[model samples]
Target: MTLLSLFTQARTYLKHRPYPVLLMAATPGSSFAALPGAQAPTRGTGTSFLQTFQNYAFDGFTLIGLCLCAFGIILVGRHALGVYHEIHMGKAKWADLGSTAVVGVCLIGVTIYLVTTASNIL
Candidate 1:
């Protein structure tokens, strides 16, 4: 609780830093190693935690994009099927197909945009 105790704690922490700390000083383009098992660093690659975070974040974004695409496909399929049934029964006009197409195109565009820009977010 006292300043001396805090100083002592800090001193102890520094004295017993793990082995990675020593290795990191010699590693290129990194303050510390990235997530364990990440590929070795190259020209633009890195062993920093930031790179690891970006990799994980990009994966999360990709998963979200995949889910969105799946949902979009399901939505478009269901809408088209319903409209087809209506047309067969003489309850719907051909113009409804335009709306369904528009919805699908818009979803595709949005997903493409998000996937392309997701990396820039970090």
Candidate 2:
């Protein structure tokens, strides 16, 4: 396959990953049902799609989750780029390369926490 095609597939795959899906769904205008297993709020006339969506999307937990997921993707991608440069161009210092891997792992951990906790919070 062409390099561009590979890149496109990679991007598409990343966007659909669970963390990214949760992050995107947390954005305003996205739909949210009462989170699974949560007791529904009593006594409301019921919520419009937009309102229900906004309510969850703007909540603190979802916002934090989205941030974490986004940071994870960026860090991981940056680390990969560093590795590529180190291998092909020999332009990155060993310490810089190593630091990228460290940051990437940390970001992944944080992302997992944020995503799982956000689901519970909803």
What are the per-model numbers of colliding residue pairs? 0, 0
Q: Candidate 1 overall Cα lDDT vs. reference? A: 0.75
Report the lDDT tens digits of candidate 1 across residue range 1-122: 99999999988877898666667766775634565675543323447889866666667777787787778778888888899789889998888877877887897788777766764563
Per-residue lDDT of 27 in model 2: 76
Kindly provide the TM-score of model 2 when superposed on the true structure, using C-alpha atoms: 0.38
lDDT of each: 0.75, 0.71
Q: Each model's TM-score? A: 0.50, 0.38
lDDT by residue for model 2 (1-122), tens? 99999999988898778797777878755454545575433323246876665555546556677776887788699767868687677676777767877877887887788687766756
